[model samples]
Target: MFQYFRDSNNSKNQVSEFILMGFPGIHSWQHWLSLPLALFYLLAISANILILIIIKQEATLHQPMYYFLGILAVVDMGLTTTIIPKILSVLWFRAKTISLPECFAQMYAIHCFLTMESGIFVCMGIDRYVAVCHPLRYSSIITESFVIKATVFMTLRNSLSTMAVPVLAAQRHYCSQNQVQHFLCSNPAVTRLSCDDRKINNIYELVLAWTITGGDLGLIILSYALILHSVLKLNSAEAASKALSTCSSHLILILFFYSVVVVLSITHSASKTIPLIPVLVNVLHSVIPPALNPIVYALKNKELRQSLYKVLKMNIKKT
Candidate 1:
């Protein structure tokens, strides 16, 4: 199956398209599974769009934190949209063939948005750290202009760094198997298909994964640690409780994001026995969070709850 070049006479022949298996173990029921997957895609896209609309319309939400949240909502939508639509096409329509250029495009988008999301989380951590640890300085520290600059910095940093991945992967010689194991154009999944020497690609991916994702995670931990320390310093139990409560939603989102990611990594490594687990997790990691993030924020945030309630009330009155 890993035959790209025909022979000495046709050595220049190379793969220009790939087939996505789209859940091999349960291939028979893949169509049935598409129902929930399609719904999840709808939910994620709608929820993120709603969040953006609410943030944009509500002047009260024009703060640094909300700005970061808006960026995160955009990232979430991008992340899921990059993978889920292609998945639905495969599962529902049996459109599994994707050209190499299109595959590389998807790969770059997935990496860019995931990294940007991680960076946005770190910004949120900083916002919370300032709000909880230094309430007085929060206003001065996290201004609208500051948030814009941070957004730009995060976008450029992730986009420029991740640009190399698709470029490098596209340059490789794909000689044999043109079928991707996962639903999406994942870095390693696509790279493993190449017949060229992939040592540099693998090493580069590892270094960036650790440096970018690991570094962002470390900063998030440190921000929360300081937040906890500050909360403990509060003399009144009620004040400490309030501070901790404010962080609960953020911590939940962070936990969910990282936990799924870690599970996906583990499943990929241990996929020798249960090969289906990694593929499923890879798809889930993209959609589940985007679908649930807005709900999480609305439930835990008083301002957001009020804004949503107001929007609903106005819509009902119009009807």
Candidate 2:
């Protein structure tokens, strides 16, 4: 419902709902863009579900790294599902109106999942580090208890840390503007629409980004550096190659995830010059990694590949 009010001196209306402008420069071809976006969303959901199933069914696949992977699959699905359907609705059906509560919920989910994903990556990096650098201690250090604890801790940390983002946004008085430039209810996009000052919101988000994402990335880098050093010290080239091979899938996923994030951040800064680019990149960020993570792991991990084939064959026979 659209709400309006007139003050003593100035006329202003409280924004009850926000209109999502999906893409600025490509309205003519925006409907066509929905096809690929829908495909990516479908792929992300199915592939991540498949990964979760394979991990659960295969007894041999139950380990710390795989457990972390199962968690990643869940996070990836959540990350994509939070924003894609609404985006597709905006694209295909031209359903752009979102209520304030729905907008806040979407914003909270997006930030929480994003932070969780980064935390999971950091945990996965630690798993790789321990496995490679101290093979003998890997089992004792990266146990199931450790995985459970890490997952719980990160979930709590990310949830609490990101809760304030939407809370802060919701508290603001949206007196005039209600059209959000981006497809989703992002913090920056939503907060920018507020008539009130958002300096506190901006500053808190900046510190939170650095504290969570930046901290996670730094930990991941440090783990990889140690893993690399340990691998280089191995006596046999074959051993070193094998050691590095185990980390290839992880490394690739990390690169793809963080590289897109970096590019998206840059595009956001230059959004004035390249508005459409940021929107496209942001959409891709939601879809691509989730769609590709399962494929990459299946391709790189022989055990996972074989398990997937077995699962597929079993399903085929049943059908």
Candidate 3:
């Protein structure tokens, strides 16, 4: 069934779109299932957008670390935005189909934001490294120019990284098997239906997945290693305690964020029979972090707490 239906080749037809069987078995309480997801979606996006606004308007958040935090917040929101709305539609609206190009765009956007987020986290770690390891030179070193360069490089790198995926995917043919396992279109899902030899595409996906995603994750880990080393060398107990506290917050976030993605990847790879309540599992990776991030930052970082409270006061006044 996976053959191109050119005029010359009438016997074979390509699959132009995919059917997403998102959460099939939740027949009993679809409304109950969808309601909480909608609420979480709204809460996550709103919280992240709020943090972005406060970071932009509040001049005190202009440091290299906070600059990366603000960008990461935006990326987090974008990532959730890409995934959650589609899930909501399937759960709440009973819409489950995505056109071929829409699928590719959604996949690409999710990967882009994922790449951007990984880079930003590593960048923030570097900021901490410099701040702690080279305290005397930190001021002169982490200029706005440096931050811009890092961010721009990350953008270009991530955008360039996945350019081959859709192009390669287009070369293959599908014989109209519209059923997809999950809610949204994913790389392996789209490629699996192709008539052409997907060895190259599969290889490319591995390269991008491991090299880009895994490689970026590696850098983040290394950055933290160095930061930890530097933190440990502190002579004073109070100084070490403070450094450890800062490290703890970041470690909590990193573990949660990456753990979700890794688990999702593993589940997606393994599950031949995509269960019902599938949208809910996807929600774990998308909505939870954005919803939890502001809370983490507010509770852990003094600066964000003060800024958050001030922003609340400003909103109260405006109302």
Angstrom error at residue 282, model 1: 0.6
lDDT of each: 0.86, 0.88, 0.75
lDDT of 3 by residue, 86-164 (tens): 8888777778887666777777787788778878877877787777778799889988999999999999999888767
lDDT of 1 by residue, 1-319 (tens): 0122123113432776889987758877778878888899999999889898889888898888888888899999989989998998998789999877778788889999989989999999999999998899988889988898988999999999998887777767788889887788887788888887888887888888899998999999999999998888899999999999888888999999988877877888787678799889888888999999988998999998899888878879999
CA lDDT for candidate 1: 0.86
Q: What TM-score does each of the candidates earn? A: 0.94, 0.94, 0.89
Clashes of each: 4, 0, 3
lDDT, candidate 3, residue 68?
Answer: 80
Q: In model 1, what lDDT does residue 147 have?
A: 92
Off by over 4 Å in 3: 1-13, 24-31, 273-280
RMSD of each: 3.9, 3.7, 3.8
- What would the TM-score be for candidate 2 when compared with the true structure? 0.94
Instruction: Give the runs in model 1 whose Cα sits over 4 Å from its true position.
Output: 1-13
Q: Model 2: clashing residue pairs?
A: none
